[model samples]
Target: MTGVLTDGPASTRSPARFVAFGGAAAVLLTVVMVGSLDLHRLTTTAVGLRRTISEYALGPYRWVFDTAVVLLAAGSLAILAVLVRKGITRWASGGSLAFIAWSVGLTLVVVFPKHDWSVGPSMSGSIHRVASLVAFISLPIAALLLARPWLRDAVWGAHARRTFRFGLLSALSFTPILYAVLVNVLVGTSWWRVLPLGYIERLLVLVEVVSVLVVAVWAIAAAQPSYRRSNTSR
Candidate 1:
């Protein structure tokens, strides 16, 4: 908010505002890259929704996919830095650790491409699968934990409520994946074959990314002079 930038003392506000803006910009960059790729897919290629997002990496747009993922990881780290600096989250806290794990997992996902069934399973693919799992599972947990403390605060309560709900929604979106697993375990079929895995994954990602954005906005709010004074007084 402009108030955040203008109300605080210039010396303190300058650095905090810069970090906050940088974090937000990084997050926005991921959105831009992903959006452009998806737009191309939608209009030019008509890439089937049933195909997983990672499928992009197997095609000409591999660089775009990889860059988006790396940017997202970088954004997560920036968000964590802002939260830690503002004391909204501690470096050793569960929320902070979850965020760190999410960032690391995202980085690993970019480093290792998804398993190509035609090529058979490989170690890099296995690591990619595990990393994707960790990244998906970690972010909502981090958002929930981080939202908890601000749930009752007047200034941040609304934003916290939004983050908490989005986190829950993001968690719930994984139910189909769980169902796929259950079907695989019970019927001895491949897990990925049970559902529209691609669509479900995309939905899950959208909700999780939204949760992250909400928390980033909250961090920006926390950087405000009014919020800082209130927090200090408490």
Candidate 2:
């Protein structure tokens, strides 16, 4: 039941531990900010559930939205750094690339405001749409791929499974949207209006963020080279 699991050298682990802590804090802050904004919208503006989160970019609180998204990207980058340091994922690996895409997409979403379908599609709006899709889609894939290796580890197996499940949940949250799209196509109705798009999207974002937090916790817990849990006595 006892084994030496190599986390990393002390020097490397120190910096990685710092990065992981900061990353987790930033991500948590993002949740707070977004949640507050949504709460405010519900009480004051009474925005409909079908309205997208990106629509916040068009409001007076645009700066807050931008800052939250930037923080999310920055935090994701920090987690990625820790993952690389711990050898959980490589810089050239598919998981790393997908994570990078997710981070980059978040940044682009902040830079480019949401598309106003009423005003018709424009270049910036198109970019924003694509970026949103990339960010939403990539994070789940990254989580699944990154957590795949440690899924069988004696110590980290439970943590890995939790991360994988969050990823899967986030990915599966899109099914309703897909079904709505297919229905829209067949009936010539608006897909966005067919369901509570905002609520569904919020669920997806929450699950994906939880996945990142789970991975960050794993990285932080496993930062020490001597870190281990034993079930058997020596």
Candidate 3:
């Protein structure tokens, strides 16, 4: 995988851009797709935000959602590839692995849409929910681990630490939202919906996107242009 990180013989500016762009794309694609959907019918009338975005996988234009998730998965792996090429540190390796696992979970969610609660849980929906929950949990852990090595990189020192701090804050914001999601899932109760469900979930999604993006964009910005010239350094 590291071998293929190169684009032909040239380094190509910086491949780290892929991760940054991919993170931005993930959020954008979801928003655009959901905006295109008929929310009046998709979301509950009383609780407009009661529905999770995953529920849209069953919509008429589900192809949009599916394609977006698949792209995100590929993008995540691309991120790992860049990190490996940059010189994998112990922390980076673990971070890369965690992100890869998160990508796989998203892939499964694409394969199996969320369950139709109206009809109760089927095997596929059950798998989807569990996958989504696990994936959500792993991303923040990855962010924290990935930040460790970057803090020590002289070339990327201050910027890396700043980005890491932002990532951690964003990840922390996701905790309660995730808990609300779990409550809806486990208790099968409408209590979670009592709050601004749509707002809460959207906040979580935004934080997740922001967390990933800060690291990715920082990676892009921090990439050493003379990497090839300084082959003896690391």
Error of 3 at 186 (Å): 11
Candidate number with greatest lDDT: 2
Cα error, candidate 2, residue 90 (Å): 0.6
Clashing pairs for model 1 are: none
Model 3's lDDT to the true fold?
0.64
Which run of 10 residues does model 3 get worst, by summed lDDT?
Answer: 1-10
- Which residue ranges in model 2 land beyond 4 Å of their true spot? 1-13, 225-234
- The candidate that achieves the highest TM-score relative to the unseen native structure: 1
* Candidate 1, 72-129: lDDT as tens digits: 8887788778777776777898888998999999899888989888889889889999
Off by over 4 Å in 3: 1-47, 88-92, 177-196, 222-224, 228-234
* C-alpha RMSD by candidate, in order: 3.4, 4.6, 5.6
- Model 3 lDDT tens row, 83-149: 5556533324677777777788889999988888788879999899778766776677677767676
TM-score of 3: 0.74
Q: Flag the better candidate by TM-score, 1 or 2.
A: 1
